[model samples]
Target: MSQQPYAPRPQDPRPRGGTPPSGAPPYPRHRPPRPPATSDLRLLLRLTVASFVLAVLGGAVGLLAAPGQLTGVPVGPAFDTFVLVGSLVLGFGVTAGLYALVYFPLREQRQWAWILGIALASMALLSTLANAALLLVGPAGASPGLVTGALKAVVDVAWLVVAVRPGVRAALR
Candidate 1:
């Protein structure tokens, strides 16, 4: 029928000296996860570059494959060669150069590069959506061009979405 002094019991979850119980992590369990590692940033850079490259490559494929369908003139080997070379230049050459412009500076954590990369990503997303809208309005239904345009739009959106993530943005900063 008597009350004792209130005190932390032996089973108190909060360990002394701010240390966690045995087998627990050094940080609090509720602590937010650390920023992405350098390797992760590198991977993200590669992924974003790859997504754009793939989008360009897919465009090159569509140009070569479907443009001929749009033309009434007979296709020739020379025409095919021209299309291939042009796509290779625009897709592989130009895209590579643009990405290189962003990639190296971004790797070095340049603030301008971060801004430029975001701007470029936004342009790419806009271009994809515009192209998709064009394809949807065009006479072709479910054509390879339309399909590829849709695919590119998906990729571009994904790239921009991931590029804006806290980890990716922090890496750039």
Candidate 2:
């Protein structure tokens, strides 16, 4: 076989500096596609509203169910005053706090909202469990207590799940 010298391929007409041709973009332009709008935010809002409503209802029920005197405690001037005033204040204060501290700020996507929400949901879950326990062990009671406890448990669990969801956390951010 005869030996032959290698030949160089033809060079591109473009400049050697890696710059694009005149009037062309300096670099290829690429943008990542935008993420789809999350519907979880709307669901979170609806769930929050429902929770607010439930809190209000529970407050009303607490006031209505308030006993005239504290039971299983010694009857005295100081004890009576504490029982009467303390219960009312603590009950309503917690409900109001949940609204002001958690629900309102949550609408504005505050970072603390989920923290407070988790606490609130935990408290609610505990309360629901207590109510269910009372209903189960106390007596053959009316259906409302059981129904309300069940609903509250479900709502609280849903709140906890939604609060930790990736979409919900991103929406808050």
Candidate 3:
């Protein structure tokens, strides 16, 4: 068999002296796409704020439903203990919800929101666990104690899941 000779590389001629590729000065390339638009962000903010309000409302309802629970630290009931307890729940719920908002602007891709979301989720999980434990041990397994404990645990877990949702996180941001 005979080997073929190597051919020289050929250059294509430009059509009618058109602008040469890479000949023109480089134009500014756009920076990485700015995150989602402000309108979308506004929606998220609204959702986050609404969720926080809902949580506060839920706490108020819970307090109304049961008046004696929600004990503060130091093993003592301050003035208007029921109101104080309810207020605490509302405050905590609102704070947790608002905590989720900090990351909403970047909710679609924000790492901080993820961190905060995880923290909030952990809080919910902990609340559930503590409530479950209380139900098991408080008042030697009183019916109301068990019920309330279990109920609170369920609510916390549910809220945790909601807070961790991508859409929710984004909205809060």
Candidate 4:
């Protein structure tokens, strides 16, 4: 006896990347159907995931740059904690979070997302370069932050190269 392949029931929850029913509400973005992420796009996504690690490290770096000492003023523990928290929220944490935002629309073939991604990558490359340069030019020996910053700059450069790939640009367009 031959068995038939099973079909999904009408009420089944739609799987990701699956088409919606004809009568479903239209999306606001008005984007055309896009192909699955290109390898370069996938690489970009991976970089965003990696950025979270950088964000945490960035927060630690804030402790090293404590505001109390830099400003030459006495401060309470509460303020010190506040500064570190602010560092995490305002610095790489936000930058990394925004990268994920760019990923979704870029995967959906949004031109604006593509543009934003390019801008984001360029800024990241510049920031990491500056951070690494500061550490290298300082009197202090190579520290963990320096090594990590240098590596992050390398990754940012690679991300920018992938972001400009013909296939990646075409998909977003």
Best by lDDT: 2
Please say which candidate is ahead in TM-score: 1 or 3. 1
Residue runs of model 2 more than 4 Å from their true location after superposition: 1-38, 59-86
Candidate 4 pairs with clashing backbones: none
- Model 2: what TM-score? 0.60
True-vs-predicted CA distance for residue 97, candidate 4, Å: 3.7
Q: Compare candidates 2 and 4 on TM-score and give the better one.
A: 4
Off by over 4 Å in 4: 1-31, 61-72
Residue-wise C-alpha lDDT for candidate 3, range 11-43, written one tens digit per residue: 644433355567654445665654553454444
Inter-residue clash pairs, candidate 3: 44-171, 101-172, 103-173, 104-172, 104-173, 105-173
Model 4: how far residue 103 lies from native, Å: 2.3
**Per-model TM values vs. the true structure:** 0.59, 0.60, 0.41, 0.66
Which stretch of 10 consecutive residues in model 3 shows the poorest summed lDDT? 1-10
Candidate 4 Cα deviation (angstroms), residue 46 = 1.5
**Counting only residues 3 or more apart in sequence or on different chains, how many pairs clash (N, Cα, C under 3 Å) in candidate 4?**
0
lDDT (C-alpha, whole model) for all candidates: 0.68, 0.70, 0.54, 0.68
Residue lDDT tens for model 2, 1-173: 33634433258656455667789888767855434435675677678777767766765554445444256666777888777778778877877777678777777776688787788789888987887787677645334556656776887888888878888777674
> Tens digit of lDDT per residue, candidate 4, span 1-173?
33734555567766445787687865547756766667877777677556546646654664564334444235877776677667656876566678667867766777798788778778877877776777678656547767667667677777777778887776665
Worst 10 residues of 4 by lDDT: 65-74
